[model samples]
Target: MKLKNNHIATFLLSFLLTFLCAIPSIAQTPNSTYTIEQGDWLSKISKKAYDSPHLYYRIIEGTNEKATSDASFLKINSANDIRIGQKIWIPGLPSPKNLTHVPKTDCEIRLWYNYQIVAVGVINEKWMQDGIDLETRAHKAYDLRHKARVNARFMMQDKEAVKTLQARDIKKYGNPDGPTFTYLLNKSMEGGQSQEVAYQTIIDSSSKTDTRYNADCQ
Candidate 1:
């Protein structure tokens, strides 16, 4: 086991991210096959499949679940834990129709949504490259999260604000551990309210937090 220095760095960063898991909370549906070559990593494999590297955890979950029944997949414990020449499963879970797993009440949504903004804000910073101080990364994200404007924007989500969405029947995310923030931009033709819209609203609301986290949370 000789792993590149970058892989070790990825491991350290991954350890830090474990503080607040941004793992996709959606259910797992392992259906694709991606041959692992040298230099393959979970984030890279996830980017290839989902067009976003942040969702790598989904592949890890999907592959591991598939392995329990088939014994042909690798049980990944970290973002970079994969072997070359091993045929890893490319995870693809069914899209959620509503928030069955997510707390339905506005207050519950508030608690979960607020928690998600901070957790994701810290994760999506992607401040793991060499020469970047981990302390600085942590401090910056913390500071921006409490900034007056950021806090104000976060405060906007209330029971009254999301009244209509609460009435709609949101689909369950299947996986209890997956992240609730589905970055999907799909919309339904049913009318002014939709499952995708409702979930996206929660995700989009965190944009301000994410922007500052990424830009200033260095």
Candidate 2:
């Protein structure tokens, strides 16, 4: 029933309310428990904890299961739902992503959400962030895509940084198709951290289209 509380259809704006204050910092590393830090992501945590980033879903399972017993541990609805200052549990034993064992539609939604996060991660890197908000950034990203729906281009100040990442993905994944991009993203730390006030505090703005791309997700 806890999982149903997060279903998009029943989603409420109240979830957007700010937490009064950040909880006191929790222990890091000694035992698998971690306080989500800026730039911290499940995959990155997995890499440090399990030696493989691909096993991030294990954290999702571990954290969510922990939620059932401890209200302090919030359930991570999706890969992109983690917020700064929250507590996360890194499972000591291997286990599948329990959350992913859902209907086919949910699986696809998860994939789409993951893509949005990756796109946001790319933009947030060394691009233009002169104190602009997420909504504005989302709009700008949408504008770039709209301007050139095919082969859109917005030069970054640090071309080499993005270029380096791009080059690495090209060599590791070959070309840049959906499957290949997904594979590369899963191994990245770009979308692992958040600079916002709360988790998913605003509109989803990392897609090639509008930030709220409900195209196939709905």
| Candidate 1 residue 66 C-alpha distance from true site, Å | 1.4
Off by over 4 Å in 1: 1-30, 93-133, 139-218
Clashing pairs in 1: 23-179, 24-178, 24-179, 25-178, 25-179, 97-171, 98-170, 98-171, 99-170, 99-171
lDDT per residue, candidate 1, 1-218, as tens digits?
35788899999899879854655432222467665766767776766676656556557666666677786776776566788766666655333333356555433434434444445433535554444454454344434333423333344456454333333313333322222222222332135666645543433233322312222211
Top candidate, metric TM-score? 1
TM-score of 2: 0.32
* Residue-wise C-alpha lDDT for candidate 2, range 54-97, written one tens digit per residue: 45655776778788899999998877789998888876631235
